[model samples]
Target chain A: MKAEAGCRACRGSCCGNPLVAELRGIPCNRRILLVGNPNVGKSVLFTRLTGVHAISSNYPGTTVGFSEGRLAFGNSCFHLIDVPGAYTLDPTNEAEDVARRIVDEGAEAVIVVLDSTALERNLYLALQVLERGLPVVVALNMVDEARHKGIAVDASALAEALGVPVVPTVAVTGQGINELVRALEERTRRAAPEAHSPAETTPPATLRSAEERWLVIGSVIQRVQRVTHRHHTWRDKLEDASVDRIWGGLIALAVILGSYSAIRLLGEGLIDHLLDPLANRLLLPLLEKLSAALGGEGLLHHILIGRLVDGAIDFEQSFGMLTTGLYVEFVMVLPYVTAFYTVLSFLEDFGYLPRLAVFFDALLHRLGLHGFAIIPTLLGLGCNVPGILATRVLESPRERFIAATLISVAVPCAGLQAMAVGVLGDLGGRYVLIPYAVLAVSWVILGRILHLVLPGYSPELIVEIPPYRLPSPSGLLLKLWFRIKGFLLEATPLVLGGVLLVNLLTMAGIVQAAARLTAPLFQGVLGLPPEAAGPLLLGILRKDVAVGMLVPLGLSPQQLVVAVVTLAMTFPCIATFIVLWRELGGRRLAASMGIMFFTAFAAGGLLHALFSLVGR
Target chain B: MGRQSSNFNPEQENLFRRTDSEEEALSNPAASEPPHPRQEAGGLRCPLRDVPNGRRVRVVSLPRGESGARLEALGIRPGKIVTKLSGMPFSGPVALELDGRQIAVGHGVSRAILVEEVPEP
Candidate 1:
């Protein structure tokens, strides 16, 4: 009942606190858990069974939290929970801890998804799950990949050895899914009559040490698995080269540059060819008519269409809920977000991110973080919210704090980056690189400082580099759509509200008052006009709009660079601020905010002084 | 236990033979008293970080505590054969090929892992 309560609470959200389950009541038999080692297609199998997309990817720790869904089989529906992948029941990390807790809380049955290619290693966890004495049907996933690798697994032999039904499956192709579900249905049915009787079922075996479990797994593998020598395919060779010291570095460089170019090309193409045209032709006339119908002069008109520039609406400069709000969110920011998630989804499903992490581990260590921190940092480049959320993968609180803080301070989301490029592109290529260079330098230096000052040690990277797989185009599109939909849902209201707030504040003359109050810091210290304070203040709500606001001010290139850098390093946009609070909690959030403000002003003042000395 | 016996390919006979010797050494330390000349050439246990790339070696001992348990869960316990793939520059994590899977262990953890090279014929 406690586990059921936990599942109920986490029905929509993917995460549930283990402590809440501990304080509750008895266990029920309606909940079946899908468990496996990391990156072994458990999530995919979950999707196959329940038709719920659990966001499967080709790397470890993708499901840092659990997701629950329902499986209806033969008129008997059961609650299916997709547990985070764990190598062992013995907790090693947060994800593993959650997995262990869910299993310990008891379930009706467990579906252990094992990788057929690496049966021996995978069997350790399977055997551990078997020892729990719960009914289990093993789904041997990725049989196709195993066959390609020259690994053969006799499903019947494995079933007999483990005394549980085993179904060979390829989750991506939907092969053998019906058989897997049928096997699960039969297994759970047979176990149901006495499932509630503790006396009828064998009690769970006492905890076995890692060595003892492996010994059992070894013998089990000897009976049912075989590996034959096979020539290395091109995929294998590419996988090897991607992790090689020299080639890995070169490939990493190319991948980074290539991804950047692709995102820019796709983003700008979307704007120029699709979104911009649709907006100007379709949406502009509607807005103009609305502007006229509202008399285009009162406070309400001002709030809706903003001020008319030369008797017409300038989408960028018109600070209205409808004029600038929709333009910034839909035309400017969404294109880049779409481009970013597309590329990132491909890289994730291709298993390239872990290699990138491995390649950068050494350098990241100096920053008081390990290589896995790179994943979160990469996610931060797309959006700071997911980047901060991905910090759950890191083991230690110290590493999470450091990574989250560094991301909030240094990493500019796609929206901010696109706006920065848009504003600075006209100045020159070199001017565009200024904020990037400053952020990069600060990333390293700030990490070094955090590493030295943080009392606890940052754990070293210990991660599996999954073999490369060709990502399915359908899967890539699904993930891209999922992320884009999430962005539109979360960002639309905030952008519109931000514009409305700006209009209301400006009308109330509060903007002028705040600008005057911060004039000393803006004018005397950062060498910017006080009017710049409004945009900088607006940066906290929506960064891209804040940066876009600067276009109308006509600031010199140097002043624009200073303001952009300060805005980036200062308070993260409110979405990121809330996520930071949730992830780091209140105390560390305060500390992180402190670090942010200090870094923003320090970097801003320093860059301002440097620019003045160079006579820019 | 019994070396898993899953590798039936003839090309891996040499690897099985090496595992036999390693098992013998583990079971009867005195019987292996007169160390093979190849073993002498390979030297005694050294940190895994110093092992040459592509050299097949047995993990002698892992760093104690949670890190050791973590490695063991991935099939890198003592006596398990693993090949050093490559180490990153500037003392980065070392990549090891274990049972057809690549695992990256941090430099510090790799240094604490004691290993001895398996002689090549």
Candidate 2:
């Protein structure tokens, strides 16, 4: 059945207008439909309601549709269907179309989940839904936050005016859950209506036009809402200034820089104190014993077990199962990955990001992008996979290419940065600043260049600034678990495999041959020893291993900075390459990869020549 | 009715509390009287723009500005009244709405408009 639809923004684009296609039948038993704006609380609510037995997520453009499950409310069982979120009934993106389809077809009832703080923005969509005339219940979620912000509403008055139940809820905490169930039960108890619904509840004579609806909304808000408080605290004022003014950008930058330093310091220290010991003292010993008992000598020993001629854990190279992958995955990489995600999540949960977007907006605009691009760029620091995927939030393909290129080139993934600090930190604590400076300058300069070359208008810097609060510990920790688990599953395997592959390539004499061929450029242009070629080539696998190998060569601080920059700008690691290929498409991917190779060499050569001229 | 995409993750309780219905539904009953859904308040209501200078009257409905398309979709249509929820000390965003939905407009956007508070029912 066609649902009531009236969104002022869309102006009858949803159910308020005529349908372009024929109405379809609802052939299923459980008639549940999901609703909300994109990136609000829909998916989380869907997951919580449906459990783990459904198609929770899917790749974009895929033909696979909504997921369904059964939910029991009181004495009744209903089918719960999770559709995509849309701004209004108006479908702009692929996800919106999915939501549109569900509503156009029949559903028993629709629950409109509105974000509490951004109520005005959300209500635009709600109005469209209410116009459809389906059984409607307003799930007034996030009530606690509204009160905290000194905003109050009158639900009873709202229900009375709208002619539907209004349920206040904190879905995450499951507050008002029983009431929601009762409301749903009340909605379902009514006899099934005729298959299709009328376009409007009343004839055109009595129907309210767009102007009348706003007038009605205004009057209802006036009657129901009471302002109990008049003043905001100082902290809220500071945030308003930071997000609203030109100076806001600078403040955001300072906050981001402070966050980065804090994360690095805390993450590195925690790994050193707790995780490193567990890996070294416990996991490594167990793995070594397991491998030995499996096979200590012979050919099976050669590939899998490795030879243990002496008592020194003797292995030809670190690539054997016992030697490389196991160590890299469990020991060298896991501690740092765990630490990185925990810190990253804390900042995200604290709501410091959108403010940073304000700061980055101008700079990004210069680079033919907008401030929101910073989100993916920041994510790139952890791993390029999600970073590339997140570029979907950007508007155009050209922006995506530039963002991907900049991220792959200038942004240092956790593994690379950790390795850089680990390798050169002991030589001089001050050396850490060099990579940061180089990256900062390169990103700025490269972004400027890309802006001049790329085509498209950078989107505006409009962002929602969530009020600051102490993050929920349980929620934050759960978020951390998801992030860290993704790292362990995706990055750890690559690091392990990359380390072993490099080790095997070196052992097989291929790396030596490659290094020999690049010896002249390595020595004459980059001013590094020819042996550095092997690790630089191997850097694509996992950056830390490349840096670890560099320890044996003993490069000076100046040389270290150049080497690190070159390594970072060179080909992205195997994982990132996969993402780049997916995001950039075949042609652009190849082009960017080619540019990266040349840039790495050219920049390193230029820096080397300059440094030598200055008597370094 | 058109369905709202339940896409938001309200993992934190506060995020869900700020919506119009939730804010009104969850208010402390002791602070004021229990809600009367359909009454038109005729008592003095504070106009946010007028503040101390303006006369108090019950909110009747939202005034539709030139951007006719968007405000309508926002559930900000007529017949419902609004009260000035809060004008923060620093004069940033002001929260107000029609029906149960809320809107927090920046000071610049809010100042251009006028509001008349309706008396309590």
Candidate 3:
């Protein structure tokens, strides 16, 4: 079923011209694709044209999936497909393959976006698209930056050189979009001229030698661009250190540690100052009131606000879907997720991700993975669902499987980590570090094991390091808003649904049956009680609530560490489970889960045994 | 794709290192009559992996198919000047700068590439 779905999705994409058009609300059946080299603001263009929030960043390989939106300009609106960025139609990577396939399927016309700063290199893609004989319009994006760098591109001269219409605009600011639309409209009008008039527009120099293309580009650049000497700037100095062998690694480390500390500080502060007061003082009473209004001892009341402590609301230990689930999703997970992605967005916008990829290139290479794995790993630190989605940036399936598996088992998402800190911090700070320590060592060992077992090697890193820019504040906030919105959308329903499911099962005696079945393993292997099984079971749903489940169990410090570690390492939450099932097929997902269980049990048992030995 | 192999053999160091007088002599054929010792080194072909850091080399050839095609699209081709930046410890991959762009070349692909040292200005 999984493989069939994968094939159908590919076919939909490969032959996806009309279908994709209709889905994005074209209605007229006319579609246009936005194509360009990676990281050149094609997504920003998509958002500008269609108003869809496609994530845009300064680094390459961000747009791995093709997004769609509708443009209602004039009486005629066409579906616009934001094709993933590729260098040429001759594809090397999976993302590039998708880009080439979209172009081959044909569109009414193509709007090829080019980075004005790198005109010649960016034009290489444009020339290939023009050779395909589609009506073309050129968008010279980032023109402001080009001018700032003492480089000027004569837009009219470039249009004359390429025999196409060129519109110079900043996609970020929606500048020149109207001019671009005008050029596009003209191309469409010229494409289907009269009833009997065939061959409306001729293909531009269909087959040219690479040498010939270079000659044309060279001449065109000479005519259009005027570069003047400039003094070295601060941006240039930072760009140098970002890729320097020694300093590069240090800067990456500093950025990572700083972000981690910030996430903890900020996440904890919000919960302590904002969320705790709101939940404890205001929201908890409202929920308890609802519980009482619905017959305080009834199942609905029990499910919503579980038995209150001493006739008052207890936020953490309530086990109520309304209380803990909502609190965990909004207050705990959201804050850390927001803090994490804020720093991540800054790094991505500042063009530091590619540099970090370069720094980890060697380390990942040794584990049969490439450097790009760092992106998914970093995202995993925030949430596992997006991390699994981000694995598409990697070029190979072998690397994707290993990366997804390692992330699910070892990387505790911020949702789970914040709860762990809250529950374990009460015992002592040292106990809080245990789960993370266990995660770090398990990642290396499990990675080595996966490397030894998995067949085939990951592709070598061959990525471009985009230059640094002072990230625009508006862009940063827009990107962050979409990300947090996405988190809330995915996190809320699944967490609430999971709580409901667990409550129903507990009422039906099913939870008792399952807990009895796993009792011996829970007691003998992990040194935890039979009732601890419920949180372990629901850990697959919402990890934060699962960690909170441990608080009411009154387990010692060592046992608390064992249970949290086991919960984190066993499997990702249901949202991530679905995403992994989609990304990797059923068979690979099963193998991954099998490995997770084996490792979780083995590590849990080992920790329990060692800690017991020390206690004696 | 067809690749044109250079006739020159690569020289590690020695007479090839100091070629200013020789280049100047070559400009005037009459003064370059001392039997051009470095003439044979002009066609100096070697794998990109062997190119020393800070030395510029022009791409001489590449194997055909995906690898060659990808390199070409990325602006790495015959006569393109590339300067070595940093190489991985185990002949893994070499970081190179060409056309003011930085890219990492893998172990196998870089080995398949044959280049000759470009003379400095």
Candidate 4:
């Protein structure tokens, strides 16, 4: 299952059969596995074919698990499995191996999705899949992209040469989905023939080598494909230079920063002016009355109503289930998450991410990582767990280590971002620049230092730059919807449960006791109050709780920045830490945590000292 | 086909299986050296040896991708010479200019891609 160098003899795992155990309970529906390289439209087609909800984002590594759903074509029902995108069957990493194993285990059939625009590269995988002698139907995706680029494909001719079905599809719009479903039906009706047929059960003496596979593909392509002359697109020449040039990098960086800022401003403005009023003015009052009727003082009441003090809902300490946690997460965090994902999906689907990666590759290389590492680093803006997990794409352990370290130490998650934008914008509109400056400086310094200190070789960049295509609106919307739903669910339960837990801890006087116990550390070392320790403790649970805790302390703009920055860099929320522990192992995780804790304190102390120096 | 290493994994063995009857056909030593159908460029000469690294040469031809026509249409087929602009220090990737277009190709892929040196103006 390992892909060693120059191992041409190794047929990829995608082109092999494993085994499948029949389920004794439910009727084993027609199981189809969607397998292909990363960034191909596998997830989109999976969603279209089976109507399954899989997160289909622009960057790689969004769909990390095998999601299952059903597709009903007429009276027939087929169960579909959407797997992680993989490059080669050689199983280079964990995710690739997961996909390999899924294919090895029997499925009714597999749809080898190929991007028509990158036909040759895409065909490499398709040829490998076909050699497996599995019941595979080639889903030639992005045909529209190809046509837009002046490449025309003869589907029937390709099908004839491949000795299997070839279905052209535009998964983003659900185009050719019915035809794909029909192709799958045809495959299932054939009952997945064994190798024992006239195809020779004993296996051939000389299997098709990689070169021969390409030759066969070339011949088939020669018969079925034609291209009319189109003027060379600007993207072809400008793409590499845009990110590769010095000035282009600066411009790209500015564009990225400006886009993020605009998204935040527009997102917050809409939510604050529109969504918040709906949630706060309409929803909260009704929820409070309902909790009142449910006997507003017991466990359920505390869980639902929170600590009601002096009348109106105290956005903070209203530590009730339905009132505080749900409201804060959904009303405050969800809208912004939705907006961020919408913008992210467009950037991803349009094929700009690779260029951005190319732009940042040189800078990242200084930190012992390549440009591909930008995927995880950007995701870290939203959350660290996925960011850490996304590091699986990094080829070297050293690059992953540095990437994980930098993200944990500097990158602020979405929740922290929301809090920063809200509080800092209100206090001193320009004060927001302070955190950005601090983070950027810290990132550069730390990244440079890590580049020197980290022990690993950074591989040279050779990434495939996909051509730009106009992103499908439905595709982008569906992607945004999927991620936003996941965020709400993941955050809502944790936030509400965290609120309840914090409430219980307060009622039992543990918050006071713990706050007192950590008083010296919070006050002397970090120069924040002991009460801030409570929020710091809750910050480990959910950043929202930590930011919520900050409200009571009533700190100045400088103090707020210090506390927020410290909290952000100190320790990620419990979930993220667990992922770090899993990815880096306990020892590395402990070391990372220890390094982060000290850095957070030292950094806060330094910032405080500098502010005082300027003040005098 | 190049000779594979004797150490084959079980998974790989399963993929490139050999049948008893077909083994006899493969036993002929001459069968091992498959025909190279690609038209070798130049007259009164064998395959060029020791094409120095970083030689500014245009690619006279290219080994196309899985879809050969698309690569051919990109002006990458025969007679479209390329220049070797740079290469990694330890015989790694070589950057080349072909038909006024530049691409970085790996050493293995580059070596197979036959190139005639571009004469200096």
List the pairs of residues colliding in candidate 3.
B8-B43, B8-B44, B9-B44
lDDT of 4 by residue, A306-375 (tens): 7677865666557576766766687667767766767677877776776676556546655666676788
Best by lDDT: 1
Q: Which numbered prediction scores highest in TM-score against the true structure? A: 1
In the range A1-616, model 3's lDDT, one tens digit per residue, is 1112223333433333432444334322366889999989999988887666789888887888888765544445566788999987778888889998888777887899998877877877887787677678899999998887777899988887777789998988889988898788777776352222132122443756666676767777898988876775888667656665666668888988998898778877887888788877888778967987987677887788877788866777676789877877877678788888888899889888877777776667656566778888988988898888888888778778989998999999888987888788888988898888999899978877776666554555667778787788999999999989888888788778877887789899998899999999999999998988988988988888788778878888898999999999996788889999999999999999999999999999999999999992
* Per-prediction DockQ: 0.23, 0.04, 0.15, 0.05
TM-score rank order: 1, 3, 4, 2
Candidate 4 residue A269 C-alpha distance from true site, Å: 1.4
lDDT against true structure, model 3:
0.76
CA shift of A525, model 1, Å: 2.5
Return the lDDT, model 1, position A496. 91
iRMS of candidate 2, Å? 13.9
Q: Model 2, which residues run further than 4 Å from truth?
A: A1-33, A38-40, A51-86, A91-109, A132-135, A185-216, A244-254, A283-332, A513-541, A549-560, B1-121
RMSD of each: 8.1, 12.3, 8.6, 10.9
Which digits, one per residue and each the tens of the lDDT, describe model 1 over residues A1-616?
1223333434444323322332223245767889999999988877777666778888899898787766656545567788898988888888999999888888878899999887888888887887777788899999999988899999998887777788999999889888987887788778453433232112365556666777777777787888999998898788778888899889999999999999999999999999999989999999999999998789998988988999998888877888888999899899999999999999999999999998788778778778989999999999999999999999888889999999999999999998898889889999889999999999988988887677656656789889898999988888888899889998898889888898889889999999999999889989999999999999999999899888889899999999999999998999999999999999999999999999999999999999999896
The chain A TM-scores for the candidates, taken one by one, are: 0.94, 0.79, 0.92, 0.85
Please report how far candidate 3 places residue A122 from its true position, in Å.
1.7
Q: What TM-score does prediction 2 earn?
A: 0.70
**Candidate 1 global lDDT:** 0.83
Comparing 1 with 4 on DockQ, the higher-scoring candidate is 1
Q: What is the C-alpha lDDT of each candidate?
A: 0.83, 0.59, 0.76, 0.65
What residue pairs clash in candidate 1, if any at all? Answer: A1-A26
